[model samples]
Target chain A: MAEKHNIKNPAVKRILQEVKEMQSNPSDDYMSLPLEENIFEWQFAIRGPRDTEFEGGIYHGRIQLPSEYPFKPPSFMLLTPSGRFETQTKICLSISNHHPEHWQPSWSVRTALVALIAFMPTNPNGALGSLNYKKEDRCALATKSQEAPPKFGTPERQRLIDEIHEYMLSKSSPLPQLAPSQASEEQSKTEEAKAQVNLENPEALPVGAEIPDQAGDRIVEEQELPVNANPNPAGVEASMESSSSVSSNQLLQKSDARVQNLKPDTRVQKPDDRLFTLAAIGLAIAIVVLLLKKFIKSTEYGAVFMDES
Target chain B: MKFCKKYQEYMQGQEKKLPGVGFKKLKKILKKCRRNSSSQKPLHASLAAKTCPDHCPVCDGTFFPSLLNEMSDIVGCFNQRAQKLLELHLASGVRKYFLWIKGKLQGNHTALIQEGKDLVTYALINAIAIRKILKKYDKIHYSKQGQLFKSQIQSMHKEILQSPWLCELMAFHINLRETKVKSRKAHALFDGCSLTFKDGKPALTCELFDSIKVDIDLTCSICLDTVFDPVSLTCGHIFCYICACSAASVSIVNGLKSADPKMKCPLCREGAVYEGAVHLEELNILLSRSCQEYWEQRIQTERVERVKQIKEHWDSQCRAFVGV
Candidate 1:
């Protein structure tokens, strides 16, 4: 593969890197390979996103990378009639060349394929080369998608697609044994239930939204809620300080008192005492004083260093 | 002597302003804390404690706070200096124009040179320090906290390269390169860093010291090629303008300015980074001046790509409106 392409070209070098990475970290979700004749042209098979009508589907697509490669987003055309996107047409997606302004050079073919799978279940919103088929139609197409690889393009491209489909099949199990009628019935019930949950709490529905639109303030409010809920964050913080001071040995007695006040857990207290004893035996000098103080504090041994600095 | 003294002064001033103790004092305290933590780890390891082994209150509460505080202080000071340097450079044009009208036109080359040289030195030393500390933290913790903190630093606009003024500094050096002819001393002091296209990849190598050389790759993380017409997102990741626009979903008509405020930086995943994207015009100028042929080719191709995108976008809009 290295000898076949001109390694001197930066685009080729990057494409080769992606090819190498894809081979090494083979994913169960999707499989991709560049065309035999052109390194820029790739064929891929992606598992349908779960929990959607498209589930159990094996969608095949072609990726045509521009000469500049990573600098430019690739054009994606799905040959399979998944019902989400028009067959044999370049899909206008944020991750595709049709929306080149949304492409990041850092994103590789792997990332794009993952994004493509994720986009399968979204409301196309009249995006160019997008289709909004009925739920039943989509499910029917999905089941059909896995029956055979869509016959398109050259025989070489078709062969690549077939191999990808085979690989995807081996990675996944046969779709759950469900009568089509019963499966559709269950799906409709779940869909209605999902709508009820969304209507009850519109906030929870964003989790299922394709593009997460989390406002900056909402995140800050979410973060502040925990702090607000925990009334003794300062006390928890003070315990932390005292424990650190225990290691530093400057204000051990003071910190120890505060630590005891905050956390009276004898079990939690035991580990620190044990750790100090181990340190005293190993180092024998600086921590010996700390260990002795802790021992005295633990045993209430005449309050020797307790009154002293 | 003056440049070195100014550099030290700036560093000391920055160190003094850090929360809690001064930088040197914090450094000493952290050194002791590190030693104590190292000693504690083996003892902790020997014991069969079911508690979280990695948790160390002393290291986390005391050592990290001081180190991170000092790091932020250094970054904040560098940003201020960079801003000041830019202000001075920008004002020079107005000052020069006034002088020309008064028939006394002369450049303030000395101040620009001094500020530029000091800024570069300051950036090199402070950047090295930050990298070293992060590396040490990661080494000691056996975690990638240092790596994660870097992105946090960037989001805060405290990243060294994130400053828009660095672009101006690059322009200053480029101008110096052309005008100064072959003054090796000036080049040595001001041009401590040089952009090289070694192995057909762009890398900026900075000779911070005789023994210490830092090489920063200039490859667009999106494209794995030399950055062309670079723009810096607010999160401080540099990418080609077109690439960034594509990532943010902002069309050429609206520009990056109108990109969704929730749009996250592709590199750091920091939201709203696109809204404040800096064009890096000066760096682009410097790049174009140095690599004329590559610049020409890129500009030609980019023009064609941009026009094609505009046409396609309008066609889509027409189809949507006219129902064709």
Candidate 2:
């Protein structure tokens, strides 16, 4: 009753309201419930995002609020089989006010939970209160979690879960899903695009066309065949004599336009894609300039000879 | 008249009972009353039962005679000199008995399960006192006990070093001294083999190292990055304190930054960042170093960049004003 008495305090009230908001509009991956009798004590269940080792596994944990309420942070203990956190161990987290100065009382239970869910999948290089398990072990544990019974098997645990489930179900917006497989696919695609752009000038490919190698090979071959066959002695000489000076001037103007657009894209796109695009654009400009330079040099030579004659 | 008045009242109350009772009836009533009273132990007798044994199995005799003899002897030995000797003898016996019991319980094990520094210190003091007494009495030579005492002292020292509170105290000492002299920018520096950046800054979580690499330990992996609002990866790896801020995407509409469904770990090619990431505390020590460095560097870079930008802007303005 004394514990319940403090629930009306501003800090506790704010956290409770936040929890209510989280439940009403549950994140796609996790849900949490505060104890009705004791608002400070909360239980959380998170559904691992699809494609992750913990995908489909539900993790349960306890959040113990400090008696000082929001002034001091809460502590966490995991009760379920999570690959990251050790089962039934209180994990020391920065946001939990375990590290006093780091805690932001403005950060509610929802903030802590959201941060927690998002931090999964990182390498636990120097973390305290983090458990190290083999990938296989983690995956196995995650799979086995489905069959693992809840520790709080009493009416209380069931009621809490039911309440959370109902709340999550009622929510129109789902928690953001961190589907690892999908992310990997997206990452791979970006990487592939980057590799292609790096290897060949992205600017060489006409806008919205396939990469230059795949798109322009047929056109390039067709042009090459005609040039190879047309070794005409007299007609070539006549054309070279007349139009050589004009073509050299046009080549110079085209290269100047390319030089202007060579600046990197400052737009806030994904880092990897942006880098790739920049590299591709640079290469494409370089190739175009080089080709134009050769054409202009040959034309200028012919024009000089015609002037001398 | 007062006595006669009381006698009259007693006689009046006893009027329902026979004044001249039969012997058989009186004897039966007396036996019943005796049996009823004997069923329960008297309070005083029960209290005495604790210290005084009712029967002596060794002598096959009641305790009455021995108790009487002991009481008389105790009274006789009440003189100051005799009482002091008796007290010393009793104390010696108690000490010897305790020592024997402790020896049996401890067997060959000298290690004590000391949960706290205070308890360890107390044990060490007691051991020292015992050693001194043993030597004073010529019960055991100093050489014979020296090694054992030394080992116990060393163990206590090791425990103190291992204790986090003690380490923190030591850090405080170092910090205070260092700050006074102004030797280094920070009190201590944390180093780690790897780093994770959130929002291009470092986040500290020491626990992450425990899970990932056992051999190569780090104080903080994400050093040099200023982790403003730190978040942890599910694997317990902490990153730019604020990096998770964006990854979780806390919004006014969303209430708090919940992990994006599509979030992946920045370090490991595998695993999602948002599924079960937590902020790690142990890594904070390392982050402190990184944060300090990051801020210092940021300031330096920003100053230079600002100057260059201002100069360029002025130059461009001059050119435009001159119609270049």
Candidate 3:
């Protein structure tokens, strides 16, 4: 019946087209129903944005388009336990009832869904379609919702989401240069440094990486050595000189490459080289220190020979 | 000057031939004659009426025919002397007397002119003077009526304010902020009423008729005459279970069942009356203390009458058997 209706109605045709496009290139944070049956009624699951109380939440709601659709508008009802609005209540919105005149016929289902997701976490007073909830309560709900099973009434709805998720994951290709193991190693080094400083306790490690594990213990030992083993003055001086020289050489190489790329008309290249010049001076200082160390060692050996005589 | 001298000589010769022709009367005749002579010369006279004829002095186009006819009737009512005086007054400077009178007529001062004499004559002369002023003042009158309508609306607002319960309820549940008491009385004044304040705001907003469904029970729950505080439970069961315990004066040591948890719910026999049952709060709130007492008294009287009727029936049957 819906297929027949879609064929007959121009508006249904446009809505179906938009739905197909949205499904083909689905956003990571949004999920929508498929276009097969009952195009007037749709369900969506939206992942909340970061840094908000609703972050990590997968909210579920139903959209009901009026029979005159596109020309009229659609209404929405939230089924999940979102703290902002009462569960299972139809919320009034500008696109719904607050301002029917502003509703444009050209606006698609995807546009409404995007707007609905973006409008979450807004202050509720006088805001059409916005629900008010305590920040703490919302944050708690958001955290709880992360573990909730992605349940839908029909297999079609579930399958649609599964397909979209698969599509998005496929599209998000891993960086070629940064291998998985190398990324983990860099992550672990930062974690070890953080543990040493005790800004956040080491016990609160990433999930699946237990605190008492052998790998965690080795990283902790490495962090401790920087503060402990480098206490000897001569060894510390040699290590510092070598580290400075290596860092300076890296900086000089970066600047040389930048200077080659810079056009003659661009007068700002000198400022870009300031860090490289500082690195060069640091390298020169390290070289001087090494020479001085050598000279001191020779003098000490000479003094030892005279004593022996 | 020569033409004027010739016209004066010609007029003197005519006067001598026709005796007793005074200069003032002759001049009046001459003026009439000149006006008549010009009108008789038909140089596009048919076009005269077509070219802006019957133009309203006030509006500068064809006048509203009905208003002009009415104005002419008013003019006709004036005596010749008053009409002359009005024309003279209009010809001089002022032109707003009629408009002022019209304004005063429509205003609170309307009654004052009705009580005065010869309004039509006075209106006509004054009407011409105040024509422009009247048009301006008519707009003012319209605005004043608009203000009056606004004040009437404000008075309606005050009426709604008097019953904040009805006002708030209508606003919350029905979304109707303003309602007339007369209309409400006409629509919803019935024997039973329901009270519901479900939204947590202190306003009762439920349909009284729809919510009042309860099965009949023989025993009062409170006075146990039949459940006096008949509350419907969540399980869709209603009983005067509380009334029964309170009426029996069962001690706290003796539980609700001691009075009767075995008491069947009037609506559903499967359900039994138990402790900690939820009382339909809306119904309880609506049933006033006095109304409850009246109902209890009425029920007891009806029970006594029923027993008397049964005794009379049995006695008559016994008498008939003895006679046989």
Candidate 4:
């Protein structure tokens, strides 16, 4: 829950801001969240952007935030079995504090996530911890990423996979929930966490239900905390999904100001749709008028119909 | 020093000329135009008209054509500015290096730092101006053409950063940061694969830049990081030499510029790339000048990589050919 965070420290504050942003308005291609126990250390699962060798892969990774916060850039490591990067090694990138001179203070965790996704398909050249995986091998690993959770992290991280699943399930509507197949994917999402990944796009994310929170820091996910030790799927009162969306929708109305910021295009799109509908109606009315005038002039409708037929 | 002063003034002078299009003003105009058309209740009837109401009220025939010309002018100006900035940096670099060589270097770093600051300011300002111009163009066109325009301007930033002048400026800053650590090895190879001149004198690289503020435009599109050992292809798209070669499927041993007729520019994906890629000499110079240590460390790292690549793929082929 958002209220549980300690927002006193700037590092915590930034981490909370970033986490809350990612949860509500997630990148359609990736999912990342900080652990309830440690805000500084985050667990992330990224869908390799489509049209690349990494396509269809759901990569799990960790982001360790320095206490210095945005002033210091974060380090990123991929944990999934993607052939491009050796699993669990700190990736050498100018954007990743590897070249501090290149780090811009304006960059945030969201920016870094974006950079990471974009940077994956590039030829490794000679970057530290990069691999020149064959295209076939990468595609094979990408397929395996969907079914297998990373073997590296702790069990709690395995639980976080389920959390990532629920987050994806609740946020991206077109995507089918991978949590059901989480058993084969390596763990099961029960009362605590549940998920698997869709290999393809469902067209779009859930349109209006996303709720953006300004981490003054009380944000609530659900009555359920992200991590639950009690793994009884049946005992839960409301279904895991039904409750998550309900809380998200409730928060939607409460944060109307911030919600608009999340979906800026929605406001512009409304007028365009209305204009289109108005134009279509006018065309329909003009055609009807033309038909009536012609029919009346021709006298008998039956005669006109017989001639037309 | 006079030229540096003039370049500084040029940025300040250009500021008002390129005063960017305002977001609020544009939005307000668009809203007013919509309201006027929609006030007649049956909105669709007007919309159904052959002329259609979405046409921009701001641009007439002359205006749209003029905007394109304006876009070119801005791009040309930035390119020219970049060239001038490069000249100033190179001139001063030569002056500093030769003075050091002659042992007459009076150690007045203020002028050097000034030039570096001026270069950053002009590049940044031109980038902003180009973005504004592109955004205005897109808003008027109501299409993704603005993004295309933005990329064109962006390539300039990419080019300017490649200039030998920036490389010198960068080296100056790198030295300032690590005053305590003597550069451990040969000239710092920015991308590590670059061939460094052995026993070459360390040129005038100090006091130009102390702040490591990197422009986003300076980033290599492939690496998503600052461009290093930058080389521009025939298409004018710039990239780190290693990145460019890798993307082109050419090995570092073969080099990007070597005869590879079938090779095409990776970003454009269709344009026939020249057998000879333009070595971003100015940019490489900037890299060697700015941070010799980083450049050197990278060279070491890439040497290991080159060996690995050869061992993994090329070594066996050579052995087979030689019957070893």
Candidate 5:
């Protein structure tokens, strides 16, 4: 099979060299090999960087080498759903084909895979095919990334992807702290929901409810709810910690059935608040006009009296 | 005179065989020393009681230590000479880079060629010496200690062939072939010296004689190719920098420097060798100069890779500070 590529092409020679090297010094972090049929297309899997959301994740991707490879960088597309990158789309990276200007001939599939791992933790900064999924969601995807190799292309390609995923599973660390934190994560979500209810109808809630939240906290939670929720799971964690601290107190309170009914009440309050601000501004403008009119009328009367004198 | 010369030659042959004369006797002598030391009798006193054999003047204890001392001496001198030659070449290269000297003295290609040749000769001679001594040791002692010592020196990075400077010298010779093309006469010194591939392994083959070709292995054990931007780890293994960096830490953005101190070499498995990795700039220059198109492409690619690295580094730093 190897002798089939006995041609004198430099790219083929380089790929063969890399294949031999990759076999000799196999890395635990990644495994890559060109297809048996087409030496230009490679399937690879990378172990996510440790201590990161992607840790314990085995991400599978495809590499399409140009005929002038090493000179021209290879194009990369993730086959697995890593929250960091959209699946089956060409990802833009300094080490990938999207940035040919940055591709080094000395860099092989090995270095690129390593770079991919390093890039896992970095901000996408809105690069093409990048996704800013929440850390929790990313962690979830990371776990899911290990479950099975992505289904793509031919049976051979699928087999290759499966083989790489298997290699990565054996190499990557066990699924991270995500497993243990899952129960607590769910508990926190329910607590947040209960807190939202309390926020909606603070007047209806008993004084002994022990929500312990200030008006400022309520305003922040309301403002940060929908827009920043996915991007900033850390904010959710911070709120979780505070909620957990007062959890024992809230556990003794009545069931949250009555709190659910008051969900619409908070929605009603937002527009009322806006209207109140508008009315206050209107009153201030009316008072200023009245004062100016009185002063002008008095001044005109004084001028007439002076002329008569 | 003819008879005397024949007799002298006959004596020399007998003398060569004399070292192996008392292997059993030496073992017995060592056992006596050990027994004496164990029983509280002085070791020398016990040995002094027995007449020393003609073939083995010194006991095994003193002979092995002295043999080791001789071995170290050979290695130490070779190391010093290699370092001095490398320093000379590097200093000249540096001065040339800075344009310190005026014309007539500015280009020292001849001097470099001579130094490179000398370094290669020194390495070859010293390596031969080590091999001859080890063979002699095994012959005398009827043991594999010489072979063991050879491997021990290799692991210790004390083997003369393992020196990074020798690779630089080869590069200089290979590069000189290109630069000295106009001076056909000077090219004679570097004739038939070039990098070649044999069975997928890269080697520097220099043909000094029609029958005497010296092959210096240049294949990066990691990449299985003629090293591109070769870096010598403290373990004395030469690998392409990119290969070593990937080996050390696939996820580290800072290349080899950010590698864990305890990370081991892929070839020798020697730990903590990556930190002091020396990038052989002279060898890199030689490779690039000798191969124009390949070098140009590599240079462009490297420049872009560097730019991307710098960009990534700054982006990460900015992210840290700006909390974005």
Candidate 6:
């Protein structure tokens, strides 16, 4: 109720409504919010699309809305150190204010964000606020993007960005567990559902329309979505982070051994010596056992002769 | 809810083996979701066994219940909007395509570059509407199917923008609102450019402003940018002429013609390439009209590359034949 009162301006109210809508049905690709002081100025971040040069990258940017927003287009500038767009410069885009004829009242911030993510990989072609970086440079910047704080937005916005990035990384680590094996299971389940529905009506599963990912992954996602499920997402993230680090440490150890092999002095050179010594000791024990067995057999024959006399 | 029930009944009937016609297959089996489900579609209230032409009722069905139903009208409204835009695109596109094809075959240079810009307004509107509808569907139903629909609709959108026959449709381009060039050959700059840098490197240096914000979603995948001299391959993937030629190892002199009819597309290498690829007229018009200087430079570059490729091919063949 208090939140509704805070937004007295009609345009501000509309912007607030959009924020609420986005929160309820958050996109997997990006997230955005207006600032506390000014609803017109929004901060946004997007996950670069998978399989592209921008993959695994988190790009941060700002959108400045006019007083007559839907009537007028917004201007955008990327603040993050993305190799694609220049920081602190208003970029020209069809959705951006550079083209008023192209702007329609129907387009919202959501549309703008989708277009922004999609545009990141395209050649800049000498466009304003556009960057044409080499793939390797962009890739290197992408790795840096994981930790680079917001250089342009406020401190609060930067904190939100960090939290969201942490969430994304933690979410991705658990995703590989669901890939090929579960996809096949989903295919079979779909077929089974179809067959069953043909005979009778669909039960609708009592589960909402969610496309159930692999069984375990789906549960984890559900648990993560609710408000009080964890109460502290940061804690869950920390544990997942530590587990991932331990696995990586094991991999690093394997690489370390190979690296040691390059230095003649540091190398553990006698790897086969223990195995050869063990084999020799086992051979000697077998010979002693054979001799003992022969002696026992001769003693038994002599005792038999004394009994016969 | 009522629509869901009727759809279920219809689907069951179709899947059933009609006891009379066991092995004598006569009727066409309309599989569900053949047309991408997420693309905007109209509700027809068809009593044709309550089943849509395709099977998936949620995405394609016309008869879902409406009491306390928030999404039915929203989806219907989006479908209407999309249908209107698509109709405009088809009407303008078909006429221009035929004219361009005639112009190409008859050697009419004037007609080839002539102004026939099909507007991108409807396409943009359709995109926004589709995005909203997909979001609404997800919000109401909480389904993962919405995610799948998104990619399906996105691919469909790309196909629409890169259609070979359609020409440029300028949207929100402020500079081109009143500006008109007299000659067809003179490429009028319809947009403005901005320059900026990052991290002391030549970072984010190139940015252009045009009629409207050109959604990167509509851009071609191969060029990592706008579809220039856009060509629609047999495999449904679109690319610039120079890019496609290089990918197929065919020079612009010989064009996309292949003796082996089996040359594969670079993107979907499994699909065999078509000899005569379709050029997107409107995209070329957009490229030339808005970015005239860049377009002219590209033409010069292509011409030089074609000459080099042709000469190289002949030299290699001749040397091999001569046992050198």
Best by lDDT: 1
Docking quality tier of model 3:
incorrect
lDDT of 5 by residue, B1-324 (tens): 332233233324431221112233334545564444446545565456443333443434564555456556655665565566556556643353344243246666565565566446545544554465556555544457668767876776667666666666666655554444343232232345566544334466766322345676656654345567888888777777766776675323676777898777776667788887877766776555444444454456456556665787789889999999
What is the C-alpha DockQ of each candidate?
Answer: 0.06, 0.01, 0.00, 0.01, 0.02, 0.01
Segments of candidate 2 deviating more than 4 angstroms:
A1-8, A162-309, B1-324
Query: Model 3: residues >4 Å from true position, as ranges?
Result: A1-3, A126-130, A149-309, B1-324
Predictions in order: lDDT:
0.63, 0.41, 0.40, 0.51, 0.59, 0.48
- Clashes per model (N, Cα, C within 3 A): 10, 46, 18, 30, 0, 28
Q: Local error of candidate 3 at A283, Å? A: 99
Alpha-carbon RMSD to native, per candidate:
30.0, 38.6, 48.9, 31.9, 33.1, 35.2
Top candidate on TM-score is 1
* CAPRI level of candidate 1: incorrect
DockQ of 4: 0.01
Q: After superposition, how far is residue B206 of candidate 2 from its true place, in Å?
A: 46
* Candidate that beats the other on TM-score, 4 or 5, i.e. the better one: 5
Task: Give a tens-digit lDDT track for model 6, residues A150-242.
Answer: 665568556555555554443332222223687777876776565445323322222222322321221122213244222221111110111
TM-score of chain B taken alone, every candidate: 0.70, 0.23, 0.21, 0.46, 0.65, 0.42
Q: Give DockQ: model 1.
A: 0.06
Give me the overall lDDT of model 6. Answer: 0.48
Residue A263, candidate 1: C-alpha displacement in angstroms: 69
- For model 3, how does the per-residue alpha-carbon lDDT over A128-199 read when each residue is reduced to its tens digit? 445677888898887675554345558855554444334323322222233369777787677656534432
At residue A194, what lDDT does model 6 achieve? 59
Off by over 4 Å in 1: A1-105, A109-309, B1-23, B31-61, B87-96, B99-107, B134-151, B154-157, B161-164, B178-191, B221-226, B300-324
Give a tens-digit lDDT track for model 3, residues B144-217: 32234323433332211112122112212121112212222222312221222211111223332223221222
Give the share of true interchain contacts found in each model.
0.15, 0.00, 0.00, 0.00, 0.04, 0.00
Between 1 and 4, whose lDDT is larger?
Answer: 1
